[model samples]
Target: MRKALILSSVLLPAITAAGIAAAGSEEKPDVQTIVSKANLVAYYQGNDGKAKVNMVITDKSGNKRQREFIILRKDVKDGGDQNYFVYFHQPADVRRMTYMVNKHAQLDKDDDRWLYMPALDLVKRIAAGDKRTSFVGSDFLYEDVSGRSLEEDTHELTETTDQLYIVKNVPKKPDTVEFNYFTVAIDRKTFVPMKMEFFDKQDKLYRVIESKKVEKIQDFYTVVKSEVRDLKKESKTEMEFGNVQYNINLGDDLFTERYLRRPPREAIR
Candidate 1:
C-alpha cells in the first residue's frame, strides 16, 4: 500500500479508534485553510533544517532491526521546492550510504531522487515509480521520507473536535494511488496531524500512522516520535528524531549528486 508522508505512529489506542467517528459542534476553519496550515506546520518549519534519525523496524515475529541516519533539508521557497540530503551512519554494512532528493510542490511535477552505496561504490538515480515502496526495507516509504505534495489530493473537513479537526483526503488521480481515501486528525492548536488512517478500495483499514509525541524546537511544533503499522502484515516501524535544528545555514551545493557520492563529513557528523 502507498504510504503518507509526515505521518504517524503504528498502533493507536482504543480511544482514537472510536474517536475517528467523534464530532463536536465547535466552529471550524475551512478545509483548504486547515490543510494549508497543516502543510506548513508539518514541512515548512524553516528555510533549512537538520535532524538525527533513528528507525526501528519490526517484523511480525517481533524481530527488530535498527538504522540510524542524519538528514539535512533546505527549502528554496517556504513551501514550493526543497532539497534533502540523507546520510546513513549506522549498520556497519550500510554505513556511508547517502541519498539526495529534490521535492517539488506541484502535483504535475515529479520529485528527483538519487541513492549512493559505499559498498558498491555506485551512484544510482532512483526512477520515479512507486512511492509506496519500502524505504531501506522499513515500513516507511520514499514519500514518507521526502513528503507528498498537498495538491495531489483533494481535502474535505469531515469532522471537528474541541482539540482536533478530522479531514478526509481523496487523491486527485485515484487510479494512481492505492488508497481509496484517508483520514487525518489535525491538532487544532498546532496544526500537526496526530493520527492518520489509510483505507483500501474495499474500505478496509489496512494501515495506520500516528504521532506519539510532539515537542517544540526552535518555536516549531515538531513530531519527535512516530510509527507506521501495517495491519495486514502485522508489522510496524518506529522512528525518532533528535538534535533537530531549524533555519540552519545549509548551502545549496549540499543537495547535489556529488554530495550523495562523497558526503560532506561536517554535515553527517
Candidate 2:
C-alpha cells in the first residue's frame, strides 16, 4: 500500500485516472519503467508539509502573468474523525484565495471539501462537477491539487533516455478528464518522475512539470522544486518548499467547517 496505494483514483474515469498501473506487454511497452520517471512520485509522501508557490501564466503567443500562495499540509483527527488539512494563503490580499479544507478518512473517495470566500464571507462546498476543472485557473486539474489515488493512471513506456523511461499516459477512461494526456519522464534507477508534460483534449503539449530539488523527509524523499510550465502561454508555476517535515501534530480544531469559513484574519492596521 505504500507505493502501490498512490496509484489509484477512486472517482476518476479509467482513462484519465491519475494513478493507474501500466499494462505488461512485451512488444507493447513497460509502463512501470515510465511511471517512475524523474522521481516525481517519490515526493508525494509525508503527513505534514508546506510550500510557497509562484504561478506564472503565459500564452503560446508569448503573454504572461504571475501570482503567489502558501500551501500548508497536516493530518488531524477531530471528534474521532481523521482528516488532512491542505491550506493556502496569500498574505497581501484577502480577496484572492483558492483555500479549501478536505476531510477524508479514505484516500480517494469519501472526502468533504470547503472553501472560504473573502467577498461573501462564506464557506461553500465545491460542486462535484467542478472538481475536474483547474484550481486557481491553473493548468493543473483540481483532482491533481486536492487528492486522488496516485496509482490510477496507466502508462506507456516510449523509450529510455538519460537512463529514464519516457512514458505516455493514456487515461483508463476516455472522456472523463479535463486535460488530454500526460507524457512524463521516469528515472530508470530510482523510480522517480523527472519531467511531466501534459497535452490538451486536442492532444497538444500545453503544460510540463519539472523537478528541481530532492530531499529526504519522514522516510520519503520529496520534490523541493516543482515547476509547472504552460507551453501554450508564456508563464509557469514554480512550487518551492524547505523544512519539509512530515507527520507533525496538527490540531483538530483547525480542520473544522467553522475554520474553513472564517480562518484567522489579521486585524486591519
Candidate 3:
C-alpha cells in the first residue's frame, strides 16, 4: 500500500487515491479524478443559468430578514473567470441593490466586486488583493467560491452513512481559507452535495450547512434549500431558492458587462 501511495501522489489528479494505484504508475482512477470529472460535468451545464432566489436570513433571537435576489451566471471565458450578477429586493434597507462578482482563475489576480447602494445612488467597487479578507464578511472567503480546482485541496473518503458519501476536504494551499477543513456529504446517486460543515483554522467546527429539497431541472440536480448555522454565536441563516429553472434560452448578451452594470428586463435573455 505504501508503494502505491507514493506513485499516485506524483500523478497529480489521482493523488486523492494513493492506495489504489500502489502497485504501479499504470494510471488507475482515483477519487480526485472522480471529483474533478463530476465537477466539470455539473459546472458547464449551468453556464448562463438564471434563477430567482428567495432568501430568508435570520439572526440571533430568531429575528428574520426576508428578501428576493436575482442571480445570473455566465460561462468561463478566456480562462479568465466566470461572471455573476446579483440584486436584492426586499427588507427596508436593502432593496433593488446590485452586487457583481468577477472571479479570476488566478487567486492572486483581482476579483472585482461592486455593490450599488440605492440610498446613495452610488456604486462602490470592492478592491481586490486582500487574501485574508472574507467575502463581504461571510464565513466563506473569495477563494472558496471562485477557485473551482479540486487539486488545490486534499479529499479523503471518510465514510458512508445511509446513502451519502462523506468526503473531508483540506486545503493544500497555505493560508488560503480561514477554516481548518470541511466535510461535504454528497449524495452517492447524484453526486450532489447534501450537507457541509466548516471548521475554523483552529480545527474547530465553526458552521454547519444542511441542504434539502434537491430536484432535477433541465438535466441538473440543484439544491433548492439550505440552512447555515454559526456554532459560536448560535445564529443561523436560511436560504431557499425558487422558480429555479435551468438551461433555457440564455443568450450571449445576457453575460455582457453592460448588463452587469445596468441590469435590464432583458437579463434573462
Candidate 4:
C-alpha cells in the first residue's frame, strides 16, 4: 500500500471498523501492524476510486499558480499492486496532459510511470530516480502522488499519545533518498495519518505533509484536503479533492498507454 497524502479515495468501512475496534483494545499493535493499517486507511479505500483535484502552488515570494486535474485509481489487491491515472484539466499550457503509474508491491520491482505531453505529441517514461522530483512543478513529488514502498524503510513506534500513534521511519538504504528519516502521527481511532515530518541528513526538519481535512464519505473516512510544505524552498502546495467516488468499477483498459495518448471518456468527463 502506498503512503497517503494527496488525491482522495473512498475507504472501506469494514477496514475502518476493524481498526477502530483494535484501537479500543488494551494491547497496543506492533509498529509494523500500525504502519500497515495506516497505509490501508490512506491508500486502499474501495476497490476503485476517482476524484477531481484543485491544486494551489505558492512560492516563497507569495506568487501563486493553480491547476485542476482528475485522478483515478484501481487496486489489483487490497494491499498489493495497484494502478493510477491522472489527467490535467486546467491551465491551458498543461491541459490534456496525463500521467500514469503501475505500482508494484515487490521490493525488487520498481513502479512504472509515464507522462503524456499533448503539445509535443510525445510519451515519456519516468525513471525510478526521478520519482522523488517535483510533480508537474508542484511541491508534491511524483512518489507523493502515489506513495513510497513500505519495504524501503524500517518503521518504529516512537511515541504513542492518547489520540495518536507516532511512528518514526528510517530508510533502510538512506543513500537512495533525500530524507534521513520521517515521522508520522496516526489517528488512534481511524488510523489515518494526520501529520508527517521529514528530517534531512543533518537532522534538520525540512519537509512536512499534513492532512488538513478529513470527512466520512460513503461510510468511510477520506482525506478531502491536504498540504505539502518544502521548508528549505519556502514553498507549499495545497490540494482539495471533490467529486470523489469509490467502487466505480473502472476498467483496466483505461490505464493502458493507448489511453495515455488519448484519455478515456471517463477521465475527460
Which clashing pairs does model 1 show? 8-209, 8-210, 9-210, 9-227, 10-227
- Cα error, residue 234 of model 2, in Å, equals 4.1
Against the true structure, what is each candidate's TM-score?
Answer: 0.87, 0.65, 0.75, 0.88
Per-residue lDDT of model 3, residues 62-137, tens digit only: 7776766777767664223667677766655776778877666554466677777767767788776554454334
Estimate the overall C-alpha local distance difference test score of candidate 2. Answer: 0.55
Order the candidate numbers by TM-score, best to worst.
4, 1, 3, 2
- What's the lDDT of the predicted structure labeled candidate 4? 0.86
Ranking by lDDT: 4, 1, 3, 2
Candidate 3's C-alpha runs over 4 A off are 1-29, 37-44, 77-80, 118-121, 129-149, 255-257, 266-269
**Per-residue lDDT for 133-224 in model 4, tens only?**
89778999877777776788999999999999999999999988999999999998899899999999999999999999999888668999
Candidates 1 and 3, the one with greater TM-score: 1
lDDT of 2 by residue, 1-269 (tens): 43332242222235333234453332322465234322234433444555555655554555554556655555442111234444444435644444555534343555566667767777778654545666566665555555433344676776777667787777776476656778777665555667878788998887777877766656666767777776766566666665556555445566666656555442110
TM-score of 2: 0.65
Best by lDDT: 4
lDDT of 4 at 138: 95
lDDT, candidates in the order shown: 0.83, 0.55, 0.63, 0.86
